[model samples]
Target chain A: MEASIRTGEKETGRKKVLISALLFMGLGHLLHLKQYLKGLFYAACEVLLLVFLPKIITGIGNLRTLGEAQPHLPIRERANSMFMLIDGIILLAVIFIFIIIYIISVRSALAAYDQTSSAGAKKTKQGLNKAFPILGLAPGVGLVVFFVIVPLIFSASVAFTNYSSPGHIPPNNTVDWVGFDNFVTLFGGDATWAGALGRVALWTVVWAALATATCYFGGMLMAVVLKESNLRIAPLFRMVFILPYAVPSVISMLVWQNLLNGTFGTLNRTLRTLGLISSPIPWLGDPWLAKFMVVLINLWAGFPYFMLLTLGSMTAIAQDIYEAALIDGANKFQVFRKVTFPIVLYQTAPLIIMSFTHNINNFGAIFFLTGGGPMVKDSTLTSAGGTDILVTWIYKLTVNLLKYNYASVLAVMIFVVLAPLAIINLRRTRSFREGEL
Target chain B: MQPKTTKVNIYTIIVLLFLTVSSLLVLYPLVYVVSAAFSPGNSIASLNIIPFGDGTTFKHFDHLFKNTNYLIWFRNTFVIAAATSICTVFIASLSAYVFSRFRFTLKKPMMMAMLILQIFPSFVGMVAIYVLLLRIGGLDTLWGLVLVYLAGNTPYNTWMVKSYLDTIPRSLDEAAIIDGASHFTTYLRIILPVAKPILIFLAIASFTAPWMDFIFPKLVLRSAHKQTLALGLFSFVTDKKNEFTNFAAGSLLVALPFILFFLASQKLLIESLGFSTVKE
Candidate 1:
């Protein structure tokens, strides 16, 4: 009788495992169907892979043959085709895994549906209880896993490889694992890496410090001036100042570019008309002046944000603080210096840091205004202007020069430079993470 | 005591007057551009604050329309911007809801990763994006540009929408669930109504970005027909025989929609700004 009981217990345990797996599989299938209705491409891919894997492989092989015979194909073209084949296969594999997971989930759900317990509707309850966590997290995790985590891994890995060139090299030329060679070359003073690094560091500091300070002070001033109880036409003034922020930076930069033209630019014309100069100011020509102009233009673009931030922060400040300051025999300047500035600064410090980081990589303003022009003399770097920030310089190197390794190296460097600042900003601005939910 | 109060008020007035005057310096370029847009001749070379030569003609606008691909550009800009804003808001809102309401294992790390990724500056990945798009047959298409914009904006918009969602209480969700309503129903009925202010703000913000974006359009949409407003304007102004007046006219035209939108939504926009700050 004891032997019989042991055999029976083992049989029930096997049944339970089978039942749970089957239920999970059924639920996953159902979810995939729902995802199909939602137009998820990956879901379709999942369905295709489950329905027919051999056909897909055959199709890819045919495409590869076609790719080989294409006329005037670059060496990298062949490599790209091969990588595409690999990527397609990987995608198919992922789809298969997804389908398998889906099937398991459905089976579990079905098992729960079938089981009987002292609790009425025990099977459905158990299935649902098992499925809830997976149902909640599967899609979200899938997306994060696929897009964010995968791309990050790929990019980080690329940093270690000599995958910069477009020409195809045999056996995974897409990512030849050079193993720290890229990093070493970057830090070893080959390819002007050190000079570029120093320049990036110097400009980052200067740009951040100046941009943040100017915008902060300027914005506070505007907010204060606009907030005066006696000031009429405050809305008009606010609108005018806020216009820079409202208008797109590209438009602003383009307009400014024209205005700064040496020959017929309104700015030069105005300066010339005022007898301030005999010739047009080479605003885009001179390195220092160009940098200065870019900063000034950025200031114009940036101040409105600070103005808005300061205005909002100011309104939040209690009116009692100012009144108390006044009662304590503090003058207007004193009240503002002690009460207003400190509160605004403390509130906006994180935002200021963010703005500073943004300026470090503000390619749009620089790219449009000068295209990082007045190209540095005698530099092998094509399309690099003296004013080129690391971001634009990377673009110049990779796109214009096709120096993928250098660009990747530079990109990794940029991240390294800004990572500390970002961490600090993220820590300080709890709202930033909280808002991400 | 009366004299002292009067003196303080006078000082305030004086300071206010000074600021008002200096503010004109900021307004001068915009005013100049507007004046230039209207001026009939190539009088932009002059520093004349007033409309100096052949004042007030619609010829520049006429020239801008007739000579350039202004209409195509306008259409492309509208299509791209509208499509990007809609897609971005839709995707961002859904993801944000998930992020906001769902307590999953990967949530914190995912959010942190997005923050870190954003810090790297998108331009660093431009080449990679370009190559990726080219491989996928997305290069030179408006949809390609839109996708790029969508991917680029997801992190920020998700953060914004999530923050907006945070202002709402979880009790609403609990009540909905107790009523046998699903998560979707709670999101649609409870969260969305409260999120209108942020939605409008984000819509306006998202709309403005693509309309003004030049670089990606320039890089990806190399065909003249696919040019956006910024690219179109850049090429127009820089093309041989600089059409200063026409450029100004095109700029003014481009600025109109945004300015009008801002005016219409000024109250809500300001409120949203305040909301973001307070929440932060």
Candidate 2:
């Protein structure tokens, strides 16, 4: 926001405007002997951007060639160009932002000149006095820039290259710009990447949907059972049930992973001791069982969250709605369906959507519990664990298999898939709306 | 009007029984894990889901304290968590203060960016982060981990803290500023104290995150000495030797603080959860 300080109540003369238009953008402010700090700030910005242009242009030039011409060049030179290309993109974004600020600053300076020249006597401080908000924001913005922004741009750029498998990593074998070859490989049904992606995509969707739906309805049902009935200790039961959620998810998932661990697991041991089973089940080693166990563990870890959420809202439902329904002779089920459930659903729908998208990227459920495994051996696919969602697949591709480019492609794809959800979630949520801050 | 003629039905009995059975089922794994921690044996090879099965021992815990770098990992996790918490609370509250008080051009877009920028699962950036940290010589360190935690916790934490601040009336700010107090001083002396509850919650949340985080630390910190409590305990079970009892002991130690905190903050937890759904 631009704050213009006025000294008087009259407009500035054309001479100051001409000086500002001709000498420099903000020179008119100094010509009027008004808004000196604002004018100086604008002047400094123009000079800085002007000075900074060449490096950005150099980066852009390097980005254009992008080392393709010098393919036969040494690894060091090739990687240098790649660095230049990526850094160029980030620089361009920065320059774009700077341009926006420059325009705002210059506009504010001109406006300040007009006002201050007219007012003539009583002047107020402007430019630096209001920089406090920005100063407050500086640390968080700096952190976000380095951690989230830079890494994101870097990852998105990787999807355009061939930085996969053994030979293409940097230094040992300089990663190169492949120009959407990775995307083509991923989506073009190449036996290696496509088969795994296809299976993984199906399982990912199924897992996300099943995990979200089951947890939501499961929690809703549990809450209904506990709350609808004349239960005195419902809060006690609810707290006990939510123990799974209150516990750190990583710990719970790991505990469950071992609890269902086929041979030495308590599940098997207890079942056997009870004479319910003669042999151990391959709870986590079989593909189907592992997938099932993944969902089961997620539900155990996830439902209590929904239960707690639904129960809280449930209690807040106005008694009038229930009374009105019951006065019309509606049965308990009808009263719930028409009144109670809808109100609760309205309250929880956004959360359910958020939970669905959250479950889509749920790394811990599969990562800690199953590690996206019992490996899918149907094809020669490398890292497609039986239960690997898009997220964990991205993980396995990067950490375990060194398929950085392929993983980056999957990462971007996951973004494309989830962006809509994010947008909707933001649009619907209280946090992202107007007047929120 | 009360339905005083109500009779107990099978549905009620079934629901009651269902709740109890499900409660036990849910508690089953937790009970087993706790039992294993105290049970004498390492593996569930000989133990049942009961306390002091075959005479439990504190030997595994003693070994963890004496042999392994468990204490160091605990210290490391605490340092990282506390640093992350304090830094996140301070930084986020500062930003939140700015956001809550000031109106600006980029404010809307910045909020949107905060929301959408986090859409991509963070693991996507893992390799890039790995490379970035490697290039900057930030790998295998706690400071780098803390930095990442701060970045990761910023968006919603800022929003949350801001919302908390938004509830404080603007009249206070105006009065303080009119009383010759700068915006910065008013924020420090008045707004922050008013928003103490949310700040505390945000700090505790940020603290607990790194204490239990597995992925980022697992990637960034490679050395055994640099491993977090999460990576350390995960390796306890994931190792070829499979130190199950030790993993249990480590996990119990790891969970005790959080569970205690959760219990202490139960009202705040429920209140926050309630606010999220009903806030609309």
Instruction: Report the C-alpha lDDT of model 1 over A331-426, residue by residue, as the tens digit.
Output: 877988899889877877767777878877777878888887766652454456677777777767766766666667777777777899878857
Candidate 2 lDDT over A1-437, as tens digits, reads 12332222233354556556455755756666566676677678778877878887878876665544345667566545446545666676677667666565555555655555567555665545567887798798878877888788888988987776686655435556778787777775577677788888888889989999989989888878877877677767877877887788888888888888887887888788789999998899899988887887788888888887887887778788888888899999998798878998989887888788888888888888988888667433567878888998888878878888888888888888888888887877665466463
DockQ (CA atoms), all models = 0.44, 0.61
In model 2 chain B, the worst 10-residue window by lDDT is: B1-10
> TM-score (0 to 1) of chain B, per candidate?
0.90, 0.90
Candidates' C-alpha lDDT: 0.67, 0.77
- Candidate 2 error regions (>4 Å): A1-58, A61-86, A126-128, A326-331, A378-380, A429-437, B1-6, B9-12, B46-51, B163-169
> Taking the tens digit of each residue's C-alpha lDDT, what string does model 2 give over B1-280?
3644346576667777988999988988877777777777766566664555667678889989999999889888889988998999899999999988898667888877877876666667787677667667899989988888888778778877776777789998889988977778888998889988788778777877786678898888888788788888887777376777888888888787777777676666767676778874
